[model samples]
Target: MRILILGTGGMANQHAKHFAAIEGVTLAGGVDVDPARVEAFNQTHGIERGFGSLDAALAWGEFDAIANVTPDSIHHPTTMAALNAGKHVFCEKPLATDYAKAMEMTETAERLGLINMVNLTYRNVAQLQKAREIVQSGQVGTVKHFEASYLQSWLVSKAWGDWRTESQWLWRLSKKHGSNGVLGDIGVHILDFAAYGAGSDFSKVFCRLETFSKAENNKIGEYDLDANDSFAMTAQLENGALGVIHATRWATGHFNELRLRIYGEKGSVEIQHRHDWSKLLTCLGDDIETGTWTEVAVDPVPTNYMRFVEAVRSGQNLEPSFRHATNIQKVLDLATVTDRDRSEHKV
Candidate 1:
């Protein structure tokens, strides 16, 4: 499979590296608004060509697929263009800035019979995959409750770098810069984590979002740091499970982590992915009586990148597909409404 990397940002490097590492895939070219950045990305990834814009690359039309590493807002248009051009797409998370756009992208991709997938990076965690398997296999015996959180201390420390001065970090904090804040950013991951691990989809959500002041007047140069910094939600799953899901950039002490605990009639399962390490623990059968939790050995799973290549090759869609992402976006969009009206919404 020949791939064109859309957007030569930080995430694009991972896309290029992963695709290039695949045995039969080629990194044919890269695209970015900045010519210099695209050229540098091409050189770094050993790609043969670079284009200053998506239009330029599409006109050349040499690649079979596109890795859309563009910003949250740009995903809709660029992905639509790629699908219209008869190219398969592997897009970054949240799919689009809003539910309507995400739905459109999902519908178009499906109607065209194209392979469309989202990079819900947490799906690659072996523990998460294992937890899902356990829940689905009836070991947990009807999930009743769950709690999930995605934590990051980027705003509290320089572990990831100074967000006050960096454009990459600044853009995420500003709504005008096409950011949906912490709620739109990591919120999707935690929602997916809880729902996927529990083998259920959210049917109702009540959300509260908070945007903490990070600067004087919350203004940083041309950027308005008004995007949400934290959010907490209570939701009902399709399988009749109740779950609490939340995410925050102000979680001090933690660099980046996703933790999920699923409670069922028979037992409970806990999964944690901190930094880069993941582990799964369970309390089942006789162990549930003593409240003993035992660690479950989990094997690694293929990443979304690898699955995208496989899906492209086999002419079949895969999990975390555009349709699934659109449903996640529906929940996210309703989250903003719930926050505004201070009320719960049915998804």
Candidate 2:
């Protein structure tokens, strides 16, 4: 299978690396806005073809699929182009910054009968899969309240960028370059995870976004820095479960932490993914003090990339499909609206 990757920044290389590991996949080439990045990415990944634009790549590079690793703002366009070109697309989430555009992309893919998958990475995690199964099996009873968080300390100080060749911190802060800051970047992952584990959709959201250090730390001409650095929201899942979502790039001393807990009438489940994959935890009975949260073992499944490839090969519908992602995007769009209304009332 031939696959062309779009965007040379962020996790593009990681996507390339994983695609190369697939049994029958080839990394045809990639396109980037930066010529230097295009050259560097090609050299580092050992891909032979590189293009300056998506049109060039699509025209000249023959491929069966596109792994779009572009920034959030361009996700809709890139995926649409790939789908229109008759290539399957594996896009990173939240599908698009614009909710209407996201819906259009989803509809286009469906209308074309193309295999479209969203890179909601956590859905591919083994422990989380186990958690989902346990909850869906009625082992946990009906979910009541849940909390999930994705946290990182990169934006706590500018030093994170000094070490990496490319850091998304500044671009993420620019409304022109990126999508919703902390919420879109990390919070979406939490929402996907919670929704996947709880076996329900989000019915409503009440959100609060923060950009705490940007005003004080940013130099006058440095950056507009309008994107959020942190966010917290409460949501009601379709199962009547009350859930809380929190994400931030300003947490000190933590590199990357994603943790979730789902409580139910009979028991609760907790899962965490950080430096290493943690075990799935489950507790039965109603006794809080005396109950024990034991670890539940889970067998590994194929990576998200592998699943996408398999779906493409077999003509099967992909999980976390474009439609699934659009629902998540709707929650995010509504969250922003809810936040705006609440903030305006406070004024």
Model 1 global lDDT (CA atoms, 0 to 1): 0.93
Per-residue accuracy of model 2 over 156-261 as CA lDDT, tens digit each: 6554563122346667775666758878887778899888988888877889988765555542244456778888888888789997889988778778878889
> Mind sharing the TM-score for model 2?
0.93
Candidate 2, residue 141: how far the Cα is off, in Å: 0.9
Q: Which candidate is the best by TM-score?
A: 1
lDDT of 1 by residue, 1-347 (tens): 89999999999999988888999999999999989999898899888898988999999999899999999989999999999999999999989999899989999999999999999999999999999999999998989999999999999999998999999999999999999999889999998888899998999999999998889999999999999999999999999999888899989998999999999999999998998688899999999989999999987899999999999999999999999999999999999999999999999
- TM-score to native of every candidate shown: 0.99, 0.93
Candidate 1: clashing pairs of residues:
none
Count of clashes in candidate 2:
0
Q: With candidate 2 superimposed using the best TM-score fit, by how many Å does residue 305's alpha carbon deviate from the native?
A: 0.2
